[model samples]
Target: MDLDSQALNMSSRADLVEFLGGLADSFATHPERWQNANLPDFLNAWAAWLEDMDGYFQNRGESVPTSASWQLIAQMLLAARVYE
Candidate 1:
């Protein structure tokens, strides 16, 4: 993940909220992701990211995806906060 890469655009209210939410979600889920906890948020993100891989490939006209994009990763991270 590009967590240490360029900053996300959060110049507006909506963007700020999205960024804040994503940030908090990531913080809450970090331990679970690495600790192998049975958190629904973690599992949900894992499954969602896997399911979303195909779309990434389709969008890029690639054969198939063996990896996730920053966007996909971000989505997963952001989504991991659903049940947090």
Candidate 2:
């Protein structure tokens, strides 16, 4: 949980998509997490979503330890072809 707030530079949309996909996969594997999902039986999913994102950032050299770091992830996702 040692995130550097000032270092919020996500390189590309592809990275975000990959992160989200991994997050979805993790959520699917953890049924207990689904209890918190807004849907009937799905996990909130955002938790795993965010965790995968943190991992993505870390892999990209950005040590994200807070929710504030998610803005960059959101932006990247918004900029992706799927979102468009």
Candidate 3:
């Protein structure tokens, strides 16, 4: 509702690309730090994390977004690393 609200932080298309590139760089630079080093396991973990993210928002007294946005997607991907 306000400028300070996280809702205002949506990334533009270019920003999203750059952000994802940064994630790629991070992963490339330090694959050893990741909990899921392979695709299948990471995908499974990512799906599980995204599924539970709504309840996490609810438990924190936040409203769960009915729709997904670029920011939410990025947050979920980041969380998937060790969310379980």
Candidate 4:
């Protein structure tokens, strides 16, 4: 299976996270099925962790961080890299 092709079909970050979570669950339930697993299965976990972090801040009356800022930062980093 082409992971990139499968990934391209995901319409949103939530979809991607759901797919990764299913994969992780499958591995956990049947380790033998993933004995040859090579690719890291951390993206979904990372997404969940970020969600928890956002929720923690929001529950404390802090504004939830928006991905817009991260997107802008990423764009600036990429622009700087190109100029370098």
User: For this target, which candidate reaches the highest TM-score against the unseen true structure?
Assistant: 3
C-alpha TM-scores of all predictions: 0.30, 0.33, 0.62, 0.33
lDDT of 2 by residue, 23-51 (tens): 56756777565456545323346557655
Q: 38, model 1: CA deviation in Å?
A: 9.2
What overall lDDT, based on C-alpha atoms, would model 3 receive against the true structure?
A: 0.72
Worst 10 residues of 3 by lDDT: 1-10
12-74 per-residue lDDT for model 1 (tens digits) = 556655665665676676855454355676668777877787887688797783453558657
Model 1, position 8: C-alpha lDDT score? 40
Model 3 per-residue lDDT tens digits across residues 1-84: 222332346457665556656667768998997899888988889889888988979998999877666587678678978887
Highest-lDDT candidate: 3
Where is model 1 poorest over a 10-residue stretch in terms of lDDT? 1-10
How many pairs collide in each candidate, listed in order? 0, 2, 0, 0
Q: Ten residues in a row with the worst lDDT in model 4?
A: 35-44
Any runs in candidate 4 off by more than 4 Å, and if so which? 1-8, 37-84
- Ranking the candidates on lDDT from highest down gives 3, 4, 1, 2
